[model samples]
Target: MSMDAPTFRVGVVVERRPSKSPWVDHAWRIVAIIPEAIGTEPGHVLGHDGEAVLLYAGARSVEFHRVETGNYRDNLTSGSPGLWVTLALTDEEPGIRLISVTADPAEGESLTEIGDLMVEIAPMPPEIAERLAAFVETHHVERVFTKRKRQ
Candidate 1:
């Protein structure tokens, strides 16, 4: 979608435990699907992680925001796509929490550093990528180059 336009997907949160590696702890995976309508919530949570501390109760959905052209350019320069996923804890309950998906790497990094939370830059599924591209095509407006007048 456009940089300003936010795309949302309703999907179940899947938790994966570290099985093969000792360095890996636990991770929450976003298994999302395109919803028929906007504002639809996921039916339920998928998988379980006893080590993960729930920030909220019940199921959680994700909000994906397209990377703006400026950020995308920066990512290209830095050899990164700037795609990030953030897991935030809520004060309401202690069961599940909402996940925010973004294309801005800086924002995601800040959240993790400042909030002391876990954030991942996992690969987006093909279906989700296609949908995101569609959203960007529909909403993104090309930036026009304007020469500045020297004072």
Candidate 2:
């Protein structure tokens, strides 16, 4: 982790409906907090008036969202809150791929005004999650099932 880089808690927003209960609203929950490196040295540069001019290269911004296994299973079972991840440009600098994880998909939409943003909301890659599995497993609490008493 870079000392200057900022860390963000990634989350998956699930919309779900239960047969026994009313539909549940979109719920955003944290999955992992990771530090992301944003700065990279420009490949080519030219000197102009004692100042280095960076060569322009065509590049697009991208965001990645990681959804935990447990959350994904619940979403599938409930069949409601569609799987979505919030993505936005990092506050540190523009044109850099530093996405902050959010629970609100709307926030991702709002980040791109013209709808040209390239934000990807997909299942959390196993390798990526593996790095933080210990943290999640230690903190995550599994729900216990208990029979309800009849009235």
Candidate 3:
């Protein structure tokens, strides 16, 4: 088995809006994933639609593991394959940071289960989906599963 893993870099575009709930001041949501990185400041505002401000939080990598090619293929065939984005906040940065993005639903859900990081999913762009499909094609290996008898 090869240890090589392919990664795709994406700009995590976040939507920042005033929170209606009193518990928090602002509500942050992952709105989109730019398939390619735009060489701009992380906190640069891309647009505001009166309801929310869109900002480029930071760049994150979507890594494809050789062993998880099956999951990637499942995601692509799920009819609504998505790019999952994970965001986190820290005292070091004083703002949200793009931690990770993945095409594998299981990994994405595991990150969401962490309970601290904010996770969101957006429809995967056709181009990126194609690239992922190609990666799956190149790295995917079929394994036979055998059920074990209980003692």
What TM-score, computed on C-alpha atoms, does each candidate reach? 0.47, 0.28, 0.87
Model 3 lDDT per residue over 25-136, tens place: 6788877778565678788888998988988888877777888988999999999999888888655432677788888899889998887798888789888899889888
Provide the global lDDT of candidate 3 against the true structure.
0.82
Worst 10 residues of 1 by lDDT: 52-61
Candidate order by TM-score, highest to lowest? Answer: 3, 1, 2
**Residue 144 displacement (Å), model 3:** 1.6
Stretches of model 3 off by over 4 angstroms after superposition: 1-3, 90-94
Question: Which residue pairs in candidate 2 have backbone atoms (N, alpha carbon, C) closer than 3 angstroms, thus clashing?
Answer: 14-81, 15-80, 15-81, 16-80, 16-81
Highest lDDT, which number?
3
lDDT score, candidate 1, position 111: 76
RMSD per model, one decimal: 6.7, 15.6, 2.6
Whole-model alpha-carbon lDDT for candidate 1: 0.48
